[model samples]
Target: MYTRLGVVEYPEIDTHRTTRLFTTDFNNTFILFLQLICFSGSLTKSSLLEAVRMLATYRVHRLPVIDPISLDPVGVLTPKRILRFLWHHGQDIFQPSHCIKTPKQLNIGTWKGIHVVYPHTPLIDCLDILLNMGVSSVPVVEHLTLRVIDAYCRCDAMNIAMQNEDFKLKINVKQALEFKTFATDRACAVIVSEAESFYKVICKLVETNVHRAFIINCSSVIRGIVSISDVMKAVVLEPGSHLNSYCISHRRFAEFLFETPTMETQAEEVDNEDTKTSCTSRSSSRTLS
Candidate 1:
């Protein structure tokens, strides 16, 4: 109707608005990131060698150790650290024939000083966690696509909260800018596609740590979301479904803050990657190939 009335699209605004970290809220959050990890393996569980493999093969930043009994996180290991250690201090690398004679069994609970977060929290919250805790991604309840997550905004809720008398006084210019500095990415949604292979989607996820990937039917409606949580949980709890169960190094995933752009890309890539199906209701069931 607006088009019929001779109105055109917003001509003045720019489309490449989100990618600039300086322009988006993500730029500020980068300061809070204590360290960019580059290592593999934990002290309690998962071998140093296998941890190295996960980092090298999967292209992740780090690998954390989990306790054998409780499956709790313990220590942080990064790819760079591992490579440095291996390259500089080659003599002490963990080898089966070297000394791991007893074959120790461990899980999550036995470790110490680990950080985590639920998936639903905003990406800004995730940044807060990273800044305050000196740790990378928290464990999220689900997986999400960056494209879908970009569609939502943090200010949308802030506007409602600010209307109260008490709240009105709180939003100063500093706070206003801080409040405005939030993700504009679409909220992660589920899609169903004619996807034939589970591994292919999972591979894409490993590279991105997205929330959910959908498999669709012919009608272009959502069939299911292959969430990161689903894939990771299955890897940890149900090994058979996981292809390279041994490779994942330290993973920083769950972010309470809204997601911002990590990749250096143009607008078309983001537009196409976002699933066509939108506003999907939360579903408890997960689809596997």
Candidate 2:
């Protein structure tokens, strides 16, 4: 589950240590947050080894790039962010030597200062992030440092949604007509807030023996994800809650069908002009046998 990305623990700067190279402030102190922003061009991502080492060695949660004199969170760095990035973008996030574009042409991935969360955010906000933005997690900010504090996932809901046939059958009867697709979308993760830590995430998942967790931020804003994998890595050293009963229940329910097929009425096969036009509009590829 561990990837060569994002942050570990936030480091506490020893005020007693003397150094002209480092700076200090309230943002970087409390909660082990990141104050300095970090960035590497899409091509520079691989070159960030030194920077990643600096943050890990210091136990800093995030590091953002800033104006030498005026500190601004132009870009932020966190372990979770790096991990997710690599998982989605691949390990070549910043490998200049691996550029695939033609020479003299700069084609970088479209990245923006997005998917950031504020300090003291709530879990519900993260739920939106997972569903709408399709991200696994968001960054928590202190003094504008986009550090990660929580993550959300649907694995929890999936467990609940995939439960007993009797329960699922009953619920499906009522809600099946409303789903956009004929596909099943049983339960979903709902993050309550920043107060919920990875501990809550694990307990909820283990208690449910489900793999996903729904996350939301403070003020009930749906921010984005925190999955079982995310929780496992974050809580790797901790004693996890066991879900023996839940797992048994989950196993029993895992046999349930996910998609409820829509009943098709038996009608005489006929193609009206409109139907013919619609069919023609759909792209079809033919292969020779």
Candidate 3:
């Protein structure tokens, strides 16, 4: 049988309780049966820059943009969507010289106190880290060399749930990495050298469809991590020269953000509504059983 994923918004459910439930019972359950916690935060009549900042600050992939008064989800914003939007419109606003600088020179991304996991670390521990650290993924490094061998991400949990009963949380990081070869959708560690241009790093992230890239030195020791948020900050919120130029360019961006939904977005909304209905029906059936 194939597993299907669905989304439902439960505003009354406690996020802390939901987290505790996952951490304690994750190994014994199917992910589809679990109720996803409500979004940690939401936007109401907010600016595009604010939305970008919120996504970066929270280290979450997406946030629901809600109606201020009704508190209903109007749209969902994600890093990938934001990046794609910027890529299309950035050429007109972003200076070529600024975009070409190295991430090191631009001082983008987390340079100090980076989090990592070892090959022998338990998969449960890694999930805990993702929960507590508010990051999507952590590099899995070799114990002796401290070299990044792979990544452990939030999506890996779903992949594990979809696998045969042999897969369990008791597995180590190394074992978890083995599953990536079979699950094509799993996010693998994307490593880049510190000297690579900022633009190149953006291209890598977009092409690979990953949230972050590890920046390593000659010996492959990680120096920092570059995330999509960091890229957005660098392009739109850069310290001095680019700020004024971006302000003028952001008008068009703001207009784009508030424009009527396209056919694609409408379709997505309909799909989400259908999924919510389906999930509700399934939940009720299980309760009766």
Error of 2 at 254 (Å): 32
202-255 per-residue lDDT for model 1 (tens digits)? 444444434445444465433334444443333333433334434443443222
Task: Assess every candidate by TM-score.
Answer: 0.27, 0.23, 0.60
Report the C-alpha lDDT of model 2 over 1-289, residue by residue, as the tens digit. Answer: 1111222232331111211211122212321422222221221233344445444445445555433223333576665555444445553333343233211122111123346534333333433454567554443433243333333234332332343433231222113223223233433333434345444444455454443444444545433444444432332212222311111122222122112132111111222323443343332211100
lDDT of each: 0.36, 0.35, 0.63
Candidate 1, poorest ten consecutive residues by summed lDDT: 280-289
Candidate maximizing lDDT: 3
lDDT at residue 219 of model 2 (Cα atoms): 48
lDDT of 1 at 25: 31
lDDT of 3 by residue, 123-191 (tens): 666766777777777888877777888888777766654566455656677888777635665556899
**Root-mean-square deviation per candidate:** 21.0, 26.8, 12.6
